[model samples]
Target: MRFMKSFFLTTFNNHLIAYPTPINIHYAWSFGFLSLMCLTLQTVTGIFLAMHYTPHIALAFSSVEHTMRDVNFGWLTRYTHANGASMFFMVAYIHIFRGLYFGSYTKPKQWVWLVGIFIFTLMIMTAFMGYVLPWGQMSLWGATVMTNLVSALPMIGDYMVFWLWGGFSVDNATLNRFFSLHYTLPFVITATSLVHITLTHQEGSGNPLGIDSYSDKVNLYPYFVVKDTYGLFIFTFLFSVFLFFYPNLLGHSDNYVEANPMVTPNHIVPEWYFLPFYAILRSVPHKLWGVIAMLSSIIILSFIPWLHSTETRSSRFRPIYKIFYWTLVFCCLLLGWIGGMPVEEPYITMGQVLSVYYFSYFLTTLPMLGTVENNLMNYFNK
Candidate 1:
C-alpha cells in the first residue's frame, strides 16, 4: 500500500502537481477547467436522458415529454442537460477568445491549440446531433435544412443527401444515426481532452505578460489547483441559476412543438452558440459559396498559428495586434447579433459586409501584421 501510494504520488506529482506554470495567469486561465467541468456535467446528464430517450421519429418527442412529466426528477435531469450544453459552449468560447488575445496558439503550443480546436469541432458535431434526438419541430426541420446543404455539392448532391438522410428526407434512420453519434462523440471528446491537457502540461501555462515562465515558475498544486477549483465553484453557481430558474431561456419556442413535415417555422434560428456561423452561412448569395464560407470561418481558425508570424508571443506587446484583436472580437459578437435577426434587407447586407471583414482579419490583417512586426522587432534588436 505504501509503495502504491508512492507510485501514484510520483506520477501525479511529476506530471501535474509539480508541473511548472506561469504565476500571473488570471481568471481567464480558470475557464479551461470550467469547460471540462461543464462537459462532465453534460455527459452525466446526457447519459440519463438517453436511457429514457427514444430515437424513433414516432416516439422521440413523446418520450422526452414523458421523461419531463413522469420519471422521478426527470425534469431536473432534462433541464440540467439542456442548460449544461449552453454553459459548456459559453465556457468554451471564453477559453478560445482568451487564448486568441494572449497568442496562446503561437509556436510550441500550436499542436496543443489544434487539439483544442479539434475538441471544439467535436463538441459542435455532438451538440448538433444531440439537438435532433429531442425530435421537435425545430429538430426535424433543422436536420432537413442542414442536411440539405449537401445538395449544393453540384452533381453528387442528391447522392450525398440520400446517404446523409438514409433516404429522401429526415426519417427514422437519420435519428438513429444521430443518436448513436451523439451518444458516442462526447466520450471521444473526453479522450481527446486528455491529450489536450497532457500537451498543455508539457509546455506549462502561458500568461498575459507573454514572457517565458522559466523565470518565475510555480507548481500547479496549492495555487493553480486551488484557483481552478474556485473557478469551478463560480461556474457551478451560475449554471445552477439557469438550470433551476430559466430552463428554456436559451431554447427556441419552435422546438417545443412536435415536428410536422408540411409546416415550417417563420424563422429557423439555431441555438445561440451556432448563431454566428449560421449568420455567415446566410451571408453569401450563392449556396455552395455560403456553405464554404461558413465552414471556412471555423477551419480558418486552426491555421492561425501559421497564418501569423512574429518574435513576440502576446498581443499585449503588439500595439497593432491589440487593436485588430479587439476588432475580431467585436466582429464575432456582431455576427452573433446578426445571426438571431431575420435574414432580410439591411440585416442581410450587414451580414455580408461583416463576413468580408471577418475573413480579411484572418487572411489579410494577421499575415501583413506579422511581416511588419517581425521587421520592427529585428530593427530594434540590432
Candidate 2:
C-alpha cells in the first residue's frame, strides 16, 4: 500500500505538475512524442487487423480482401494499420535526424541512441515481414527475395535460408512464421522503447546547445507534457486524414492482387522507406557484397559516438560541422530517391556516389571536423 501510494504520487507529480524544461529544445523534439502517439495509433489499429486477418497462407490474401469488402469498419482498420507503418517510419526518420542534428547520440547516454537504432532495425524487419502477410504478388516475391539475402552469409547461409523458409522456398510456413513474428516484434520494440526512455531520462534530455548537467536545468513535467500533448494531437489529426481520406496512399496497387509465385512484379521494389538499402542491394551485381553493405549501413551508425572526437555538444557552436552534416542529410535523401529507380548506368553511378558520401561523412569527415574544432578552440583559449 505504501509503495502503491508512492508510485501514484510520483506519476501525478511528473505528468500533472507544471515544470520547466530546457528552453533550448526546438520543435524537433516534438517528433519523439509524436512517435509515441503513432505507436498508440498503430497498436490500436493493428489489434483490430489481427482480429480480421487470416494468417494461413491460402487464406491470408482472401482474408484481407474480405475485410475490405465485407466487414464493417474493416477497411478503415486495414488502411490505418498499413499507412500507420509508413507514418511511423516517417516520424522515426525525423526523430533520428533530430538526434543527429543536436548531437544527441554523443556522450554519457550514447547507449540510449544506440538502442534506438536497434529498435529502428527491428522495426524494419517487422515491417518487411508484415508486408508479406497480405500475400500479394509483390508480397510473395518480396519475401522470397528478401529472405534469400540470408543465403549470402558464410557457411550456414544456405541452411539459414531453408530454415527461414521451412523449405527450399518461401511458402505456407514462411507466411505463418512471419505472421507470428510480426505480432511478436512490436512488443519487443515497445520494450526497447521503455529502455530508451529510461536511459534518456537518466541522462536527461539534451539541448540544442549540447551541454550536459547545466545549472539552468528544468523539470521535464509541465513544459514537455503540454508540448508533447499538442504534438500528439497534431500527429493524430494527420493520421486521421490518412485513415479517412488517403488510406491507400502508402500502399502498392500491386498488393491488391493475390500472391502468385509464378508471375513476378515488373518492378519488384520494396516500400519507399526501404529503397535506399534495396538500391544498395541491387546496385551490386553480386548478391553477397550487396547484402554485406546493406547491413553495414545500419551497424555503422552504432559506432558514431566513437567516430566523432570533438568535445562540444551542439552544432550551433560547430559551424563547419553543421555544413557537412546537412550535406550528409541531403546525400541520404538522394540515396533514398535513387533506390527507387531502375539500376541503369546513370542511376547506379549516382547511387554509388551517394553511398560513398554516406560512409565518408561518418568515417572521415566527422573525425576530421572534430579534430579541427578542438584545435581552433585551443588556439582561441591561448
User: Best candidate per lDDT, number?
Assistant: 1
lDDT of 1 by residue, 14-124 (tens): 876788888889899899999888888889999999989999999999999999999999999999998889999999999999998888998889999999999999999
Residue by residue across 102-147, what tens digits does model 2's lDDT show?
8898988689889999999998998999899999988998898898
**lDDT accuracy of residue 146 in candidate 2:** 90
Q: TM-score per candidate, in order?
A: 0.96, 0.95
Clashes of 1: 0
Clashing pairs in 1: none
Number of backbone collisions per candidate: 0, 1
Give, for candidate 1, the lowest lDDT window spanning 10 residues: 209-218
Candidate 1 deviation (Cα RMSD):
1.8
lDDT of the candidates, in the order given: 0.90, 0.84
Off by over 4 Å in 1: 1-9, 376-382
